[model samples]
Structure formats: C-alpha cells, structure tokens
Target chain A: MNSSLITTKTQRHKEKHYEVSAPSVTQWWSWFKDHHEDTKSTKKNDMSSDGNNFRSALVIGYGNTLRGDDAAGVRVAEELARRHPALRCLSVHQLTPELAHDIAEVDRVFFVDADAMADHVYAESVEQTPARSVRSHSLSPTSLLSLARDLYGHAPRQAHVIGIPAREFDLSEDLSPAARTGVAEAVECVGAMLERS
Target chain B: MTKTITISPVTRIEGHAKITIALQPNGDVAETRFHVNEFRGFEKFTEGRLMWEMPGITSRICGICPASHLVTSAKAGDDILAVEVPETAEKLRRMLTLAQWLQSHALSFFHLSSPDFLLGFDSDPATRNVFGLIGHDKELALKGIRLRKFGQEVIEILGGRKIHTPWTVPGGVRDPLTAENRDRMLAWIPEARQTVGIALETIKKVHAKYKNEITEFGNFRSLFVGLVSKDGALEYYDGFLRIMDGNGNTIADKLDPKKFEEYFGEAVESWSWLKFPYFKQFGYPDGMYRVGPLARVNICDFIETPEAEEERKVFKKLSGNVGVVNNSFYYHYARCIEMLFAVEKIEQLLNDPAILGTTIRSQASINRTEGVGFCEAPRGVLFHRYKVNKDGVIQQANLIIATAQNNIAMNRTVHQIAAHFIDGKKGKITEGMLNRVEAGIRCYDPCLSCSTHALGQMPLHVELFDANGSLLDSVTRS
Candidate 1:
C-alpha cells in the first residue's frame, strides 16, 4: 500500500498548519496557549484539594491511526472533543513521560486506548504502578502516573483506563465493524463519566 | 574440558542479543561470539510497495531510532526523484536527526549503562537499572528523563507523532516548522544543554573511577567508518564516507554513497543470521570496524559546536589525540560529547530563520531507477538502497543496518573481554565478569530490532556448557 497516499488524521491535522487563516485558528490558538503555556511544572498536590474545589481532568486518547481499528482511541478522543468541547484532550501514539507533568496537576486523568484482548469496551480505575525501570518510549497510563508521583511528587487524584475493544490491527485506514460500534460505546461511556465527574 | 558461559539478551538495550564465552580446559578464555537470533524480513515485504511509502514503512524497523530510518529512507527518495531538498527542509532534517541523537544517546547512557557504573557492576541485577539510579540519585535520573523528553517533544512537534511519524517524505518533510514551534523548540534548548552538561561532567567523574574497565574492556585495534564533512568535520545528516585505522591513520576518504558496493561487502556467517559487514579493501573479519558514537568521535576531525569541541580536545588528549580510540569503553564518553553537540546543534537550527519557511518539499517525479541514501544513525552509519520501476514501485530493497555493520567488531570485542575476564575456574564466572562481557556489547548499543528486522520477541538466555556439550548452567532474562 502507498502509505503516503493514505492521509491520516495526523497528516490532515498537519496540513492545517498552512491554513492558519481559517476561522478556527483563533480558537485553536487560544486552546494551544492555555494548554501549553507555563505547563512545565505541576507540582501542586492534586489529591490535596478541598472536596468542593473544582477538579481539572486530562483525557489522553492514544493509538496508531494507520492501523485498522487501532485508531479507536483517537476516534473516541476526537468524539470527546465534539461532545465535551471544554475538556482537555490529547491525541497521541502512546503515553510518554513528558505527559507526567500534565497529569500531575490534573485532579482526574482518563487514558483511552484500544485493547485487542478485551471482549467488550470497558472503563476501570487505574492506580499508579511505576515501572521498576523506565523506557522513555514505553510508558503506560499507570507508569505515567507513577512517573508523575516520582518526579513531580504527586499524581492525579483519580485515573481511569477507558478501553475500546479492537478486532483488527493490520496496516489499513478503516476501523473494523465491531471497533466502530465500540468507539460509539467508548464515547458514550466517557461522556457519561465526564458528566458524573 | 572447555566450558562455555553465556550471557543472554543483554538487558536494557533496544533489542535482544546474547554473548557466549568458551573457556579452555586450563581455565583461560578460548573463544567468544556475539549472537543475533531474530529475523524480520523487512526488505522482502517492501518489494512491490510504492517507493514513497518506504520512509513511512521502514520507520517501523526500530521504535528507539525510527527517526533515523525515516530520515535515511527519505534521503533515498530524494536520490530517486533527483531533487535537491529545500534549505528549510535540510535544516529541519538536521534538527530532527540531532534530536534523535540526543534522546537515543541519553537512553544508552542513563537508562542502560549508568546503572552499572553508579550502582557498581556487581550490584544486584534488580537494583542495577535506571530505577536504582533514581533511588541513588534522583536529580540525575530526573534530568536524564527530562533530557529524553526534550528530544521526544521536539520530534512530536515536528513530525506530529513520536514513533512511526510519516512526516518525512521522499523529496522533503510533510510540514514546515511554524514560528511558534520554532520558538517552542528553542525554549527547550537551554535546559537540554544544561542537562547534557551535567551528564558530561558526571560521566567524566564516573570514567575516572573505571580505570580497569577502560583498560581491559573491548580495547582493540580495528578500522573505523563514519560520515565526515568535506573539510573532515563531524557530519551526521550527509557527508562522504571516511575510514580510519584503529591506531589513528586515515585509510580512505570521500567514498561516494552511490559507489558503496565498490568498497563495502557483506559476509554471511552460519552461526548468526545477521550479516557481517566489513571494509571490502581489508576483507572479512580483518576489515572489521566499530561504529556509532565511538566511530563517529574517532573518525571525525573536529566537532563544530563549542562545548563538544572542548570535550573533543579532552577526549583526544586522554587518548593521545589519535585518529581513533580503540577502547570501546570510551563509547559512553563519546555518547555524552555527541549529546552535547546535538543539543547545541538543535539550538543553532531553531534560531535559523529558514526553519520557519513553508517551502519544505520539492515536488518531483521518478527520475532514477535506483537510488542509495546513507546517514549516521544514532547507532552508526545506515545505508538504504532501492530499485524502483518506472512507475515508482519498488522492485527490490537492501538495507545495510548499523548494528550489522558493527557485528564483526562486536564479536571481536566480545572475544577480547571474554579473554580478559574469564578463566575455566568456577569462581571466574562471576556476575561481574558476565556484566563486563555484556558491557563490551553495550558499548555498541546494538539495536537488534534494526539488525535482525525480526518478528516476535527475542528474550536473552545465556547457557553454560562443558566441552562434552552438556548443559552446566543457564540464566534466562525475559
């Protein structure tokens, strides 16, 4: 397959770099500034906040968009943006240490990923489980929380793994039938969870 | 009876590999071999794909250094289209390459090798890792992680993703650097530079303590090969191939990448699936040479960056300013110097106005039936050659991976260390000895994923056998 011909959401997103004059540019600029500026440190104890204080949530949707059905996480993340536009969402290939600082300041974190082993979509609470040793490229949600705790002295107050059951992993752009259904379920589940939060 | 002691799947490396040391009946090391045991036919799968897909597809070869493959394959695409990459694209490519160097070298030093030095080689394996380094010194460990994060962040900003970024195409990159992203990248340089400075100083102090390791580990005389600028300075993105002798003599210079077949040859060995690449002039094992940080430092005339330039001087003075430093243990020191240079280079590129230019690609059609591209990967020099049909469909592909290029040198180094540390006596086969043997290979930081290009996981298992071929003991790390 001509992978170059297969334009991914990432490629399309990058192509948007040239269209900076678009109407949404100002909105994106604001979002970028608010999310990125002065985010280098998040050392405040997220769990120590008063029960009545507002809690900020970080929603990370990670998957390879090029692989069939593997893009479910990214799809759910994109859908979450539409359903809950005010939420902080990051679309990535995987969880990395750089996200630790971001995770540290947030009171809640939702890690959305595609799981081939899962028979159905599900959401479960995830606890900090720091790796004995770390590979910079291979951090998981638990590891990122652990890293936040280790480096920043605190992790998010609550973290949940939102898993979308995936059936196909081959090199293709189309999601599987079950995965398409799973994406909707994941989006609804995440939307409900965000509402309850 | 001769006894064999094996250390399987040297831990904390990018991929799996093992080392076997044979002990003679009289309690002296007899032989040693470095084994790569996995096969992923990446080349075979590439046959019939559109040539433009290579940069994207081949980037999957190794997660650690996928940027290297992506950049190198794109260069090959450049050759096929016969179009000069725009100045902005070149700058971006250089910046990306350096970022990769920064992250990859940091990994080798802090995560893989530092634990052995800081925690002591004889320390418990469980604690002798990056975590141990963190427990022993939190600031240093955190600095290492942040330094790596800086590189990965730069990559993500430029390519839109960390691993398997399809941003790099045949003629140029997919997107140009925005002024915002440029400033964003520039913002990270000061801290990145400071971290590398800290690491360099720490390694120098650590190096001073490892007198025996420096003297005995993988110290041998062989040739060195790497890319050098026209003026014989350090060049990683693009340069002429230069070869230097182990004792610091220039053997050959300005060998064209297109003409590599004339001076490079690959020899297949029955025991290892990885091809043993050697200098054609010297032939087989005799032409064996080392690459990666050690070879880059050895073969380069000078580092252009200021801090690294000064570090180079110290390195030269320490090693008599010779053309090559035969000791592989110095690879750690060389890695630090390169990381410093990469950080400096990144800052330089980010400041360049052309980096903000939007004209990153040069549109072109198929202009050549075959093309070859070569670049210095984080591990060493990597070459990718492709033959395409008139319609741009790849007919055949050949990848000369860096680790395979260092196979002969790694095997010889394994033998050298095995002989230095091993004896037939039971006590000689201590964990420290095993570590030193593994340390010899670690000097190369061999990425078996890139070398073997294999499917499935390959865990390390070291086996000890008597002359009669009976298993005496084995240690397997999964």
Candidate 2:
C-alpha cells in the first residue's frame, strides 16, 4: 500500500470509530470539487434544504433499464441526482472498450451496477477491498483501470463497487419488487457515501 | 418438358439455401441459378434506432462475419458524422478489422472449403465433412480449427462483444486499448505463425494432388477489384481500391470507392435478387469483376510479411509473375497467403505502444453529412454509404456488399467451370463437377445473405424458339 493508505490505516486504529477521512488524494478530490462547482451556474443555494450538501462526492450508477432488475443502479443514480444538487451523477448502461481509458482517470469513483443475485438476496455491496472477480463486461471497472494504468498510466485514486443483486435479467422492461427495493436502498447508501466524502 | 434438380436444404454453411438445376427433356443446357432460401430483415428492424447503434445491431445479421458488417456500418456512421477521427482510432479500427479477416477467412477457407481439397472431389457426399476431414488427417483438422478459434478470441477480447461488436462508434471507438491487453494479443503471434506454416504444408499437398482442380475448375477471364495500400501493398483493412483486368493490367488505381457511382454500375437479373455489379466502361457480364482472394492476389504488388512473401514467391513461380494466374480455383492459394499475412500483421499492430495509448477514441464533437465507408470484407469489397441529416439521423443509406458485387462474376465463373470440366458423357457429368463449380464460388466465399437474394435452381436452362416467334422447345436441368 502507498503512504496514504498506511496513514489512513493508522488513523482508523487511533480513532477506533467509523470515520472515513475522505480520499487523501488531495489533487484528485479537489478536482471533483472544482469541476462539480465549475459545471454549475454562479448562485448561492442552501445545501441543507437541498437534501443536505452532496459536497465533493461523485456518485455514478450504471445498468440497463430494459433488463428487468438489472436497472437498479441506473434508477438509484437517477434518484440521487434528483435529491442532491451537490452530487455529480452519471448513469451509463452499455459500457464499451471505447470508454475504458477516460473512465479510469477519476480521483474517486463509485460504480453502481446490476449483478446476478447473491444468496438470492435483494442487493449487497462489497464493503471491503475488492477481490478479483471476472467481470461480465470485458470493459469492467477493474479491467478498465488496468487499461488506464497500462495504456495511459492514470488509475483513479479510489473505486468502490455497489452491486445491486438482481432477480431477473430477462428482456423485459419492468422492474421486480425486490429490484425496486434494492434501488431505493442503494440510493440511500450512496447518499451516505456522498456525505462522508 | 424441362426436368429440374432441387436441393431445398443446402447445409454446412452459416445459413440456409435452396438450389435448383433445370435441364431439357433431351439433356440440353437451359438456365442455371443459385437460390437464396432464408431472409433476416436487419435493415427494416434497425430503422429508428440511434444511428450510432447500427454497428452492433447490423452485426447480428450473420454469425460468420459479423465484425465485417459491424465495422463497415460503424465507419459509415462516422463518415456521415463528418468528424475527422484521431489517427490512433483509425489504426485501432483497422487492426480490429484485420483480426476479423484473419478469423473469418480462416473459417471460410480451412473449415468450410477444405473438405473438397482434402477429400477427392468425387469423394462420397456423406463422407465429405469435418468428420471425414479428421478421418483423412486429424492433425490438419485440429490445427485449422484452433487457428480459426484464436482469431475469434482476439476479436472478442478487444471489441468486448465478438460476434456483435458494440465497441465501434461514430467519432472513433468508444474505448481504448491498454498495454496488458496488447501483450495478451501479442502472445498468440508465434503460435499463429507456426499454424500458418502447417497450413502452408497442407496447401502444397492439396495443390499437388488437385492440379487440374486448381487450374481448370473455374478457368475464365474477368476484371478483378480489391483494396490495396496507396503504396501498392496488400492491405485488407484500409486502402484505396484498384481494379485490374484478367491479364493483371491496372484498369483503375486509387479509385475513390465513394465515387463508385462514376465507374461502377449494377444490373439486376430476372432470376436472381442479387445485383450484378460491372464496370461502367465494359457493361453487364462483360464488365463483371471478381473480388476476395482472387482479386486481392491479382491487384497488389507486394505482400508485407516474410512468410506471405515466400508464399507469393511460390505462387508467382507456379504461375508466371503477375499475369499468369487466371483460374478462379487458384483463389485457395491466395487465401492461404492472406491468412499468413494476417498473422504477421496482428503482431506488428499490437506491438506498437501507441496501440495501448490513452486516445483510442477522439474527443471531438460530431456533425452530419453524406459519407461513404469502404473496407475489404473477407469475401470481397464491402461498401456502406450514408447520408445523415443535420440532427445526425440517417437520411438515406446505400450499401454495396461484397457478395452482391460478385454476382455477375459468380454466374459467369460457374458457367465456365461447368463448360470446361464436365465431360460430354452424361453419366460422367458427376457431382464432382457441380461441387467444383460451387467450390469456385466458395473460393470467393460469397455471402448470399449480404446479397439481396437468389431466385432458384442451379443448372443450365434454355428456351428455344423460331425466328418467327414460334416456340420450339423448353430445356431445363440435365
């Protein structure tokens, strides 16, 4: 691990309380803040009234809408974007190799996508370090980051996987009850992550 | 009355076909037609879709060479957008396209066309298959299939979706390649080279035994058209086109295929839905041209790699330099050479660090205009022209597919093969002769699916009438 990761390990031990100090990649997190601000119009808006300040957090949700419960992530992204004015939101469905290079350059990134059901549960997020799992997509987040580092030498500072356990991946355009619940919870969880960031 | 032979289920190909042969009661030549029996409506279904979605959507039309159509359509959209893409993007597309050629042509030549060459043309029909091929020579069968699969794997890895590539798009590609992926692709090269070496050995054996089949199966003269580098190198992925005569003399060079309207024309036959493309200067069957392996072999002055160069040397030595080869059957030789060339090319393209660079796609805005996309499909030259509105919706599209481009020539070559090789004795006019004629067509690897359709029957048909409009006799399949 790098010095920042080591420093965070020590800080967590000393505090003994669950307090994430945000991404220490200063140039990177500040980048998110600057761009998130730059993209907005010059106006002083009350953040507490706007569903609390989203601040410098970037929330991304991706999945296909017509793919049954597989659309959970996108639905969550859509809701989050509406709720938090400060949250930078993007909902990409069909990712391709063509997008790999650019996607891997973020200081901190969160991917919200649909996945095959886990233990047949509604949804689950991997809370710790990611294990090497083969992505259903050739241009999965890990592979894309590998590509960025290999081809472009610019891997993002942080990436977290928010996988919504999906019940169906059929060709239908409707969402199941379980999938709907997963999306709501995912939105809530992402709202929490944004507050921490 | 005329008699006919109909094979309603033509198997062992990507799709289905029904072939009918017509002959007179007394066994006189009448008319011959290759009929297409199945239809998949890709064009009608793809309408109203985001024009950028065409590449992936159109690819599903055929599983055999989906990448060809995918790349062609993607380029079409890109061209219409009037965006000047980055060089890296163009090169990456070409590299992917060449990979498609390597796999598709390998499938066409070694998998589909090999049984005829390996087994005797007169071999029992039931035994003329991959099983039979394995029984004849197990190692050759294994080697060929493995090589084909490797090509498929490479495409799948790079494009994300292999059979239906969703990665290509308007401004360039949607993503870029990394050093890790490039290294993975490069690892396959040396083995690919060895596989070609084995294939070349098989080529020599097959050619030696089937000398007459090689030389006279489809012996006829026609104009040949193919894509070659501006520098006259054999380039399948990107290049201006050159049309050469039977004697290998250049009729046209650096001809903007987009301006094909100026030099090329198509005629429709009453019997076949496929359009017969011909040179405007020559007209109809007279202006007919052959493409794919035969044309590629004829047009280019140089082969890029050492293995392909050596094979070219042997080809030129067997047939005298450029002008000596005229038989359609010799296309097998050209196919082998191209396969070798593709293997070498993959290594060269992937090794460039630029291939693994950050700019796989250009970060430019897109506009709308009329544009044409041209690339050499494994079977032949494929052209896609599109006109997009200011809002970037497709206004109109015209596609001249590789198989459609060879319709007139396929008919003429079939006629020539039947005339030259079939014996006068009716009993000796064997299945071998028909298969030989079909094999010649197979050499071009015509995708009748890409062409509009074929009417029916596969034999000479003739109707006799007196000068005074008196009907004498009607002849069908013999």
Candidate 3:
C-alpha cells in the first residue's frame, strides 16, 4: 500500500500478487541468485541431477512423527524435497513464533498438516490476519503469518495450508493406508503448484 | 450459613487450575485450595516401554520445559546403566539446561508475572498481559522477545529443533558441541547479560514500592529446598539435595536422590490431581516447603558468578541475611539473579576446551534394576525414577516434578493471600482481591501440565462452597 512501490488490485482474484521495486526485495533476489549459483557449483560433479529450480517458497510441515499417520505432513515434505531438491522445507513438531523470522525471508509459504477430520487432500489459501498475542504452546499458521507481518516487518507474498487427511494417530510408527494415499495426492497437488510457479 | 468462592482456571499460567475458598458461618475464610484439574498417567503408560526411550517419551510431559525432562530421563538411564557420562557430554548438557533456564525463567518473569508488577494489580484484566507490557514499554517487550529467542536458538543449535529435541541420551548426549554453536552462544552473552541486568535493577526498584503487598502476599515461613554444589553453591545440572528450615537452618545436606523416597513424601487430596510433596522429617502439612527460584536462592550458600554473586548479596541483605527469604514476592528478584547466573555459566561452559570434544557418548548396558535421576529444573528440583526388568523394559516409573513438589506450599500461599485480601463479611469480592489470589499462585509459576499433564479445552471454572460442603456461588472464565 506504500506509494513508493508499484502495486495492483484485482476483483476476481482468488490469489494476491504484488510487483515490488523495493531495495530490500532487490537485495534478497540477488542474494538468492548468488546462493543458487553456489549450490549449482557445489553439486556440479554429482551423478544424478534434480533439475527443478525451486522458486522462492517456504514449506513448513509439522506433526508428531511418533503418532501414526500424523507424520503425513513430514512425509510429503520429504517427497517434495526429493522432487524439488532446491525447495526450502522445515519439519517441526509444531509451529512456533521463532519461525516468523524464517517466514519473513521467503516470498511464499505452505503449511502442511495432517487433518483427521478431512476426507481427502485439500489446499486453501491463507491470508494474513491481525496478529494477536497467543498464550499457548503453538500458533496457527495464519497467526504466524500475521506475526511475521506485524513484528518482523515482512510477510510472505503468498501462503496456503496443504492438509492431508489422516486416518490414524495412535501409537504406531507406520502410516495408515488411507494416510499414505492422501500423502500421494497431497504430493501431486503441492508439487504441481510449485511447478506452475 | 457459610459461603465458598471459586476462581476457575487461573489464567496466564501454563495449564489449567481452579481456586476454591471456603468461608465459615460468620463469613470468615476457613480454607483455601488450589486444585489441579488435569492428570496424565505418564508413569502407568511408560511401564512397558524400553528404558532407553524415556528421554524422548518423557520429554513430552511439558512443551515449555521438555529439555528438563529429557536431561533428567537421560540421567535416569545413566543410573540404570551405572555408567558415568563423558565430561564433554556433561558440559554440553549443562549448556542445554542453562539455555532451558533462560527461556523458561524469561517466560515466567517477563511474559507471565511481569504484568502484575508493571501494570498495577488493580489494572484492567483485559490489558494485563504481555501485550499490555508492550504498550507500556516497547523496548523492554522487544528485549524480552529477543532474550527468549536467544535461549531457544542455543537449544536448536545443540539439539536439532527447539522443542522436544532428542539430543540427550543415556550415558551422555548424541551430539558434540560445535565451534560454530559455541561462538554464536558466546556472542549472545553480552546482550543477554545487559538485558538481565536491566531487568534486575528494574525489579529491585519496583519491589521497594510494593512493600505492603509483599509483606501480605503469601509472605510466610516455610521450608526451602533445592540442589547445591559440594561447597553449597547454586547448582542446577548435578548436585546434592539441600533442605533448609524457614530460619535458614539446614534440615538435611547431601541427601542422595536415589534415597529421595526416604526423605520426601507425596500426599494427595481428593480435590486436586496434583500431589502435595513434603519433607519426611516433619510429616504431612508441617513439612511443606517452597521450591523454584526462592528455594534455590535461599538454599545456596553463594552464587558462582561475580555479577550474580553481587545480586545475591543484595538479595540476602533484603532478607536480613537469615539464609532464607520468607517473602514469596521476591521470586521475581531471585529469578532475575538466577538468569544472570545461567548466562554466566553458559558463557563459561562454551569457553571450556573440552566442550567441543568428540567424546560425547559412553556406551553401557543396564546394570541396575532400579535407578533414580535428579536435576534442578527451571521451576525447581525434579526427580525421575524407574524400575526395570532384567531385559531393560521398565516395570514401574515415578516422576516428581517441581510444581508437584511445591504443591503444598502453593496451596498454603493461596490460603494466606485469601485470608488477608478477602473480607467475608463484605459479602462481595473485588476484582483486585481475585487478582491478588491469582498472583499468589503465579509466584510459584506453577505449570499444571508438568504437574498433572492433560489435554482438552476445559473452560476455567471457580465454584464457591459453603461450610456444609455445598456450592454457594460460582464463576467460569473462558
């Protein structure tokens, strides 16, 4: 909304995008380019190549791995890493306020969680809300986005929650068949989104 | 007829609890109770698990201080194996514990209790929180955030993630300290030291203004308990148990934690899920003792670092150097000093040459069927005990958390505050009176989750009971 930067507003848009000429954005873009170049040179001698150049994205996958099928989010994150080697992914037990710092550095974020109440893999766009002080062990993804915007001075340009339906959350290590199927669908959906970007 | 008042699910603390105040026929306060509403059968659930999995499993008891559980469980495992952990691993664990102390204490002092001191107790309840503190002093609020972040950052560097990192294991830790982590932690020391220094100074100055409140707010004589080094210096990671009388006399020194059952007794009441732990020497209610920062400061002969040592001297002077401080409100001061000591200790550990050694773990099999582990958790001294079969599967488990240990003392403090603040004949309680009652419990920073861990969104409820044991009035907060 600042007058110094170019902005666009649209009516039929389910997604919001901004074109920025801010010096900070320019600096971050150059830094990412340099980092990508360094990564390419470092892996120059590797035999097998992961060809996809991941765009600026932050994927946060959180769930208790100790609880069966609840690890679906982490599993999808692992799958995404294999398919898009350069993507930034964080696997956590829960989302904490500290992650707001990381969220500020990216242009896009995806919060993946196992939804026991869901029927199938689902994805929804997350818009930042006014940040409020939370008095709990963890914060919701939207709350984290709000925190990043209010406290850290920058929020991700886009964010979404990729929910994978989970069938079991008992004391077992292996995922349920339903959760496995859901993870596959989730992987395809999230992977396609990244590819299109 | 007598009447009772209830304050349900005390807010701004970890976990859920309610306070019940009973009044006599003449409208005089008779009894006050702090009831823990949730309980998790952790001991029963861990019965069939392998002893080695305890460090990870038990760490889930409380998300706020999982490192304490992890370290204590690992130590219990050490006792089972009967093997001494390597020196480097011990140093690394010490660093981890100190980091936990920093974060936990910061949360208690700055986020939880600071509002009571900063914003007057009579301030609007809606605004009496960390956000309120932010409105009053943005710099201080930001400083607290960064301070907590620094502590969590250290934990992340040591283990892998901040919460519930399975870095520590039996006989030692699984990872060695790296030069990068060491340097990063050291760089944070100066700023941390500055922030705590300012906090200490601010607390001391403000404490003088609340003299009347301090004297009347849960200020009573009770036994104090904590861990102390061999020379009776403050020790958090490993030390001998030291118990002191209200007047600064030693009740017991160098008590072995394995023999804790002999000196400590846990009593349960029908009204609450939390156990009331008391010193065995006096029996039941008479042996009630306070723990956490107040107990640690009172039990220690001296602090290690010069800066904290100076604060200790000031603290003692305030308490008339009687070797014990009876006032519960001084918890804020003691917490600040301990945080200073923790930072200093962290800096010292990081500079130790052996800290970065690769010899982090020692391997050993179960040598004992029964074992005990003890450490001074951020709240107070915590004990983990387990009895295992020959195959290394746990047969029984017992955990004495810091909050549970201070349960009796917390209850007594509530009674004391209610007696002083609540005027039964007035037939009405002011919001400030309720705030005072809640403040008394906050002094201990009781984590109901650590004491009686549970899940479910239970709305906070407070019910009043008459002398005939019937409900008179009730209040619920969501």
- Name the top TM-score candidate: 3
Q: Write the per-residue lDDT of candidate 1 for residues A32-67, one digit (tens) a residue.
A: 345445322222212212122223887888765656
Instruction: Write model 3 residue lDDT over B1-478, tens digit each, in one string.
Output: 5678888878766776888888888777888889887775678878999999999888866767888988999999999999999999999998888898898888777767787789889887666766577678756766776787788888889887635657999999998877987898899999999989878977987787887789877788899988999998999989898999988899799987778889989998999988999998899999999889999988899999888998888888867756678988888889999999999989988889999999989899889999898888888999999999988899999999998988988888889889888877665656678889998888888876533111123355666666676665555543
lDDT of 3: 0.77
Give candidate 1 misplaced runs (Cα > 4 Å).
A1-131, A134-145, A157-197, B427-430, B450-462, B467-471, B474-478
Best-to-worst ranking by DockQ: 3, 1, 2
Model 1: residue B276 alpha-carbon error in angstroms: 1.4
lDDT ranking, best first? 3, 1, 2
Query: What lDDT does each candidate get?
Result: 0.77, 0.62, 0.77
Q: Deviation in angstroms for A155 in model 3?
A: 3.9
Which candidate do you rate higher for TM-score, 2 or 3?
Answer: 3
Order of candidates by TM-score, top first?
Answer: 3, 1, 2
Cα distance off (Å), candidate 2, residue B252: 0.8
lDDT, candidate 1, residue B373? Answer: 81
Residue lDDT tens for model 2, B258-324? 7887888988766555677889999776998888876886778888888787887677666565574
Q: Please state the error at residue B191 of candidate 3 in Å.
A: 1.3
lDDT of 1 at B221: 90
Candidate whose lDDT is highest: 3
lDDT string, candidate 2, A40-108, tens digits: 222322252143334434455655454467667767777877776666666654333333334454555
**Predictions in order: chain A TM-score:** 0.70, 0.60, 0.72
